[model samples]
Target: MSSSQLPVRAAGNLRSDAGRNRAEIVSAARAVFTEAGTDVPTSRIARRAGVAVATLYRRFPTREALVEAAFADQHADCSRFFSVVEQHPEPWPALRTALRRFCAEQARDKGFTAHLLAACLQGRAPAGAAATSALEAERLTALVRRARDSGAMRPDVGLTELHLLVAGNAGVVAASPPDQAAAASRRFVELFLRSLEVPRRSGAGDGVR
Candidate 1:
């Protein structure tokens, strides 16, 4: 091949390799983070990806960048679920489904649960995460408002209580053994949902507060 053609081919191959390396690094990061926490070393993720630490660093300069990339798909899943909830006609059922989904996700991925709790409760978000968090918050606020308006949810229940429910479920899942976490999370979600609903009453003013 001509020298100019050779250089072009080399450049194309290099770009292809770089893309592959990035994909591997992200896949490895997700697996490692799920098994261990996000605190695991970068070198370990590099080794798991079968890539050099330098390569991983080239693709993601910071640990948070790697983490954000690793969980990107999960975040997309969340956005999609929120969109589905927004379209549901019954606000209370939609809210309950969303809560159940969140608890199930926490049971499935401890690292993600820790990351989400830290982001939602502690107001910490990596580079591209802030916008996504804001969008989700807006969607949740609308859902809560609709539920309250429909009288299915207690008037006092709001985002703060919802955040508390999430934090509480995260703790429940974390404390439970692996084999029991999912069931425990489900039970916790049901209990929280019941508490958030308007109480049934047989007499006037009996269910107030």
Candidate 2:
């Protein structure tokens, strides 16, 4: 190869290798965080990724960076759920589905639960991460407003109340043993939904009590 061409090819190879390492580190972080919590040492993730600690550090820089990158999939899933909620014509069912699905997912993934709870507690997230979270919050607020306007939900509820609901659900997921977490979260969400709903006009109760 010509000298110029050789340098270009070398640069391309380095880029490819960097991409591969980033992907592996993210994949390994997901598995490691799932098996353990987010607080586990970064060396474990580097070990799982089959990379040197310095390599992992070069890619992620910090634990939160790795956690944020590892959680991109779950973040997308949450956005999808919000989109579904936004599209549904029936507000109550949409709200119910969103809560149930989100909480259930949280229960099933302790790593996600830890990530979410930590984000909530910290009150600030990395810029891109914070943007997605803010968009989710805004979408949920709109949904809740629509539900309230439809008289399907209590009129007094707002984003603050929804935040509390989510926090409580996260707590349930955090407290339950892994095997039982899903069921417990489901039950809690069901009860919470029932409490939030407006009663039917027919005076025939829907067994919420």
Q: Evaluated with TM-score, which candidate comes out highest?
A: 1
**What are the lDDT figures for the candidates, one per model?**
0.83, 0.76
TM-score, one value per model: 0.83, 0.77
* Candidate 2: regions farther than 4 A off: 1-13, 113-128, 174-177, 203-209
True lDDT of residue 204, candidate 2: 50
lDDT of 2 by residue, 64-121 (tens): 6787899889889888878777899988788778777767766667687556543443
Clash pairs detected, candidate 2: none
> For candidate 1, which ten residues in a row score worst on lDDT?
119-128
Instruction: Write candidate 1's Cα lDDT for 95-177 as tens digits.
Output: 89987887788788867766765655445564446667656666777888999998989999887898799889878988999
For this target, which candidate reaches the highest lDDT against the unseen true structure?
1
Give the backbone clash total of model 2: 0
